[model samples]
Target: MNIPTRSAIFLSLLFHRTVLSLQPPAPRAIVVGAGPVGIAASLVLASRHGYDVTLLESSPETSIQTKYDPTKAFLYNVNARGQTLTKMFPNLHDKLVKRSVESKGFADATITVVPADPNLPIPKSSKLEKSFEMRNNENNEAGNAMPKSEKAVGVGYWIPRHEMVGLMVECIDEHNEKGEGGKISFYTGKECTSVSPRDVGGVFVEVYQADLVVGADGMNSKVRECLSHPRSAVGGWSLDCPKPNYFKLKKWRSPASFLRIKVLQLPPQFEIPDAEGNPPLITNSENIYAIRSIYKGPRNYLSLGLLPMKNNTAVRATNIVTRPDHEVWKLKDGNAIQTWFEKAFPRMNFNGMISNEEWDRFARAEGTRFPHCQYSRGMAVWDENGDSGVALVGDAIHAFPPDIGQGVNAGLMDVVCLDRALSGLDTVTGKEAKSAKENDKPSLGKNLARYQKQHSPEIASLIRLARFGAPYQYRQPHRADRILRTLWTLNVAMRLILNKITFNLVPPTCIILSQRPELTFRQVMRKADLTTLFLKVVVFGLIGLRFRPRLEILSMLKP
Candidate 1:
């Protein structure tokens, strides 16, 4: 093929410009937060829908982390549910999988059980010692072997929060360079001080006005606060009481807010001595190691969960969790903290793993309190004219502990659900006519309302699930309580196995069967309730049957 002449190229450019000039202006959206959810939202809104998206972040450009940041180094396991969003863009999904450390359930994990109270006598007759021995024997026999059937379930790729955000930004930049979709303008150091419904139509984010506003700025969201508590925003004055144009979001905070977590930076390729001759540290970054301990007779306990970092250069980030009244919180100085660590984890070499600077940093860190799992009642709001719209996604609407590791996954699913609503997929079936014609622009108010209706119940269910379906681990202190929890878990597991073995009459536990793509959060909760009911019925029926013979004998003897 020959190259086109300059005149021909100029004419072609002129014709394209003329066509573009005749088209209607694109809708605009303002997304608050440059984090993973916000960036993904910007990509979808701009690319899928014809919207000029503006992404705003409070932090400066230079301040945004590109690597392992100790202060904000939280490990996120992007589960299969969350992967649905990334799969929307094949390139983005590939990039994420390439950078993340893949985990195939506990088959790749290690559990190191160290006694918190070293002085306490753990005889062979004790359950604790027996458990240790059993675990050791299993390790010796199987060598990190998991049941073949359980391999595919609960598969997630791990990535640091900031790194994942960085990858998202990079993808958006590449997409913008290609000029493939609608335009996106990203602004840094832009903090959203307030949000208000526009007088004519649309919403306002500080000085910038847009047709829609998305609040993904996290748990303490200004947009959520302003919209939900308008009276407080107006300084105790209520101007639009009778005909309030905005929707009010009411939230219920769960009671599980007592847990707290602190990040401890440790050296890579470190090993702890085990009874099986100090097995080399699994350097593939696939296995998670939990350094756990039992309750130290009347004293509080601190547990360490080590999330794998990339084997080579990245430092390991160990999450230490405890209650506010735990003994670890009372340590005043760095030396005290270091000594405490040495005493608490005698197996692991804390002195060699943590540097003096890291110890000082750990000592100064106040640690993050696990926020109560809360969900908003009304997540979407629009003006009376049905032109302006606002929606809450991610932590802004539902904030909870990371016990379930659904923080990022649930947030991403929220975006996907919103996308489905906007596309009219929720209402219209294949080849079925939509409520609006093909040429008609999507209704912001109607779609947002649809999203609210579809997503609210799921959010409520997720919050409830996070509150109760969470595993105890060491959240419970007493030995008897731990034993009860273990028995209950085993009972549930056995019931599920029996169900599978039979015709599947009994429902599975929400905690174990949550990651199945087919089951939504609401379905998970319902199944868990069903399983509990089934168990209760079985127990009481057995009890009545066992006492029936005794009752009959006593009746015959007595008048």
Candidate 2:
């Protein structure tokens, strides 16, 4: 009994060694979808936020190939809404900018408002599109209602998606190596069917349970399928006339759809100024620019944007044709490919730019296509399914027309916001050291709820803008909406009137947005939605008058 007191001290020391040496393993995170978004998410979480991550991707060969493939890779535009990474990930941003063609001085997007009549001649001169000097040099110099882009030095940047992807992967890897033993693993060719939901805040991803399952897995996500309601609808997939549900429930619809897209890679010579013995420039501006055309038909329209590739090796153009998916199958033959290109794009010729064999490759190859709008942004960030913490980011939560250039941007933005949301997360172990109870993990409910509340508005805005601007931006407007075209004629007339009144010598035509990086999709979308009837009438009238960009014409009318 007198010797017993020493025994208690030995037991205490034994317990300390056992618990301290084997502390709960760091919370494990599984990221599905190894695209730029998913990779970015994994990088941010591991290198910056310090989370163990395993990234899984479905496509092995397809996603990595960025060669001059008509079917696989296409050009991408990064706008003000997407330029936030410049500050957050400066190294990554700088790397991407270096690989991308500069859109400020060397190249910018020229929104050409062209008359749909095939007979109309496309003006080849660059002077027709106004310049920043021209905008400010007006006699009146009234800047009252002008969009800020007119005053800025640049619009945005364009990079081929594949090249961007490669650069991003490189950046992530380089940065991650410096991390202090951060667990980051990536696997390709893993098409996850369905994952078993865990109880304590992780999922049994093919038997290896993780602490969190993030579905960065695009529109048609099986992880989304796991969280979504069995019977549901989202975007064009559920075009049923009745109301099944809105954002309240998990809704998965039919296979998502996309316009039969035809992408082309032209010789660098394609962008040479036509005024300098070249072909037609999209705008009248003398600066090298990416051309965005809003070709207006009687009832339908098409929005085409083309940009120069890195080192000026090639020019890339994307043609979004609204055809039945079944009809626009793979390339039939070289003649068919040539005929299709000639028919879809009558203005540009690829004869010398691309050989017949190349054209066939362009037409025949199956390119990357996204869903029209497949999965709902439904389900909670951390809901009690079997018992895991499941969340979705990127196209899984919000993907639609892709008009606002929000696909990659939205996903990147989501990662930043989510990281902020889970800043002080406790990283409670799900089942390794705790009870099998769902409540065993530290509460992440409020943190997740706050994330959903704060982020959903932007995503909602994304959906709203995408759908509303779809017809106007590219597809066909309604018969009633077409009346606005007559009004656009008045809009052009007003620009001419103001230019005359102000004693400005510049030609008065339609004006396009400067594609300013500071210009938010929400702001632009709101203005487009609430535009006065008279203004719409004027803007539409200008289009009827063959005035291209309504923004410039409207600014001229600003008192």
CA lDDT of each prediction against the hidden true structure: 0.71, 0.53
Which residue pairs clash within candidate 1? none
> Over the stretch 1-559, how does candidate 2's per-residue lDDT look in tens digits?
3565677989989999999989866667788887777877787667665678888888776445334455555666664545664446787788777777655522333333332234454442232234322323532322212222232234456677777778777766776676664568877777878765443446666655776677788777777666543433322112221122433323322112354456655555453223334455432221233232333343234444443556544444555444333333645677776775555545545565578776766657555554554335452345433223556788878777554456676677677666665653322211122223557443444445545555665566556545433222332333444444334434444555545565744223322222444444454455444433444686789777785557678988999
Among these predictions, the greatest TM-score belongs to: 1
Instruction: Assess every candidate by TM-score.
Output: 0.81, 0.65
- What is the Å distance of residue 413 in model 1 from its true position? 0.4
Clashes of each: 0, 29
* lDDT tens digits, residue span 1-559, model 1: 9999999999999999999999988899999987888888898898898789999999887246555677788878898988988999888999888888876654343444443444432222222324434543633522222222232375688888877888888888888898877888989899999887755667889999998899999988887777765333432212322112233334444333656678888766666544444343433344455564543542466566666555456787877766576787787688988988787666556777678888888988888888877777667776665566788888888888876778999999888887777776572121222555578656677777777766888998998788766445444444554555566556555656756876668765566667676678898899888877877898899999999999999999997
Q: Let me know the TM-score candidate 1 reaches against the reference structure.
A: 0.81
| Residue 7 accuracy (lDDT) in model 2 | 79
Which stretches of candidate 1 lie above 4 Å from their native place? 1-20, 107-154, 230-256, 273-284, 292-300, 427-442, 478-502, 536-559
Question: Which regions of candidate 2 fall more than 4 Å away from where they truly are?
Answer: 1-20, 62-69, 104-155, 229-258, 268-305, 314-331, 339-351, 363-375, 383-388, 424-442, 475-559
Which candidate number has the best lDDT? 1
